[model samples]
Structures are given as C-alpha cells and as structure tokens.
Target: MDGSDDKRLDDTLIALRRILRATELYERELAQAAGLTPAKLRVLQILSGRKEGNATPTAMANQMGVRQATVTALVDQLENRGMVRRERSSTDRRQTHVVIAPAGVEALRSAPSALQQHFVANYQKLEAWEQQMILSVLNRVALMLNAADIEAAPVLTIGDIRQDRGRG
Candidate 1:
C-alpha cells in the first residue's frame, strides 16, 4: 500500500480499538455500580428482554461464546441471589431453561441507562448527513474486519469475558 493508504489503515485500526475499549470500560463500571458483575448484568439484560423460553444455558453460552460449564457457574450464582431460576424445559423434559425473577427485574430496572445521555444529546444535534457518514464509515470498518481471516484469537472485552472470573 502507498504511504497515505497505510496511514489511513493504521488510524482506522487504532480508532476502532479505542472505541471498543471505551465501551467495555463504561459497561464494566455501570454494571459494578448496579451491584452486579458485568457478566451477570449482561446475562440479566439478555434474559429480561427475551421471550419466556429462550434463555437456555446453551443459548447463553453460545451468545457469550463461553463453555457450558462457565454458564452453569454463572447461573448458579444468579440463582443463589434470587435473580434467576432454572426450570425444566416442558417439551424436552431433559433440558433446563432459565428465567429472570421479579427481584432480578427490579434490580436491573433501578440501574442507570447504559450510554451517557450527553453523548446521545450531542450526536442528535449533528446534521443528518454528518451522522449518516459517521455510521457508514463505522459499518464499513466492521464489515472489513469481519471478513478478514486470521489465526489470532478474538480479543475478549470486559463484557465479552470477565477478568476476575466475574469482574468483567
């Protein structure tokens, strides 16, 4: 690539990494302030918005890209705290499903919103075309990264995988 092309590529990569880190850090702090580990909060968030039977252990493991055993431990902790409960799947009888408890819903309901309100307020004030251009660039960057094939393992963010087993 030419010098300008190389510079652009490096700048794009750096900016994307920084944005991801910032988002993860924000999520981690918010979850902690809500009295939850990041992983548990994500699990609660996932369960809260789902259909009744959808938050199975297998589904959660796949969504989080973790092993089944890890999900089991997470569920165990949530269950102990009365945030989640496991039920036998009616159709299979052998499969277990997780549902959020009322306490879980109330706990999460009291937490602050995820993104900073000021960011949204400011972003909305930008011209429509400017907003569209920003989104277009971000979409293209995401697509290009997704299409590349490499041997490197996917980087786990605080939300993607916890650091202190549950600290996010």
Candidate 2:
C-alpha cells in the first residue's frame, strides 16, 4: 500500500518485456542462422536424436506435446526445405515416418543452441521446491494475462506456436 509498490509493478513489467524481446530476437536469429523456424528445427532435432533419424508425426506430436497437425505442418515445411522425407513404414504400410535428411542434420549442426536449452539447464539445477515455485508463479502469471486457455508447447519460440489446428 505504498508508492514503492507501483515501482515494483513497473519493474516486473519491464522484466516481462525483456523476456518477450529476447525471445523475439532469438527467433529472428535462429531463422537467419539456420534458415529454419524454431518449430521446424525442433522437429529435425527430435528425428536426429532418435533411432534411425526418423519418427511418425503422431509420435513427434506426443513428444513435443503438440497436435499431430502441427507436427505434420512442421514436417511438411521441413520436407519442402529438403530437410526431411516421408516414407511408408515397412512394418505397417498405413504408418508414415518422417526421416531427417542430410540437410536436416547439417541445419541442426549449423543452428545456434536454442534458448530453451539454456533455460532448461538452469531450471534443472534449481532445487525442486524452487522449480515448483517458479512453475507456479509462471502459471499464475499466465492466468493473470488470460493466457491459461492458450495452447503452448514446451518450446520457447516467441511466435510460430501453431500448437493446435484448433488451439492445441
């Protein structure tokens, strides 16, 4: 109940803005450096680290905690860029797999490290209760911003969310 509280609020807003600005900058940098969006880069990373450098779109969606359509869209983009290819599963003809191409591997190698990787590393080093508290505060802030209903994947890109075809 003091004027200092108003200053605190301004500081908080500034901090949030900085985070937003940093994310936007990172997105732009990644695109310029690797010629790929965050989502597409993530798709390639997933396939690259997986067995045989391939996975089904449904599986990728689950791993990324997004919708199949979003993953499909990312896959389509990567395929167009010659970063990945689609193949029918030999075991099940009905299932198609997205396989990372040589270009995908090169792109991954060329891309800068993701901002989320730094966040995740630091987050994991925090105490469990600290981590939980940070999560609680972030969730509360989302609710305060009326963003609790928003569908966001674990990725930290500022844009290109496209999490759901129908708000996934």
Indicate which candidate wins on lDDT.
2
lDDT tens digits, residues 6-115, model 1?
99989988987887787677666666666566566667877987876348988887776677776787788778889889998889999999999987887688655655
Q: List the residue pairs that clash in candidate 1.
A: none
TM-score for each model: 0.56, 0.93
List the candidate 1 regions with Cα displacement exceeding 4 Å. 1-17, 115-156, 159-168
| Residue pairs that clash (backbone atoms under 3 angstroms), model 2 | 164-168
What shift in Å separates residue 80 of candidate 1 from its native position after superposition? 2.6
- In angstroms, give how far residue 143 of model 2 lies from its true place: 0.2
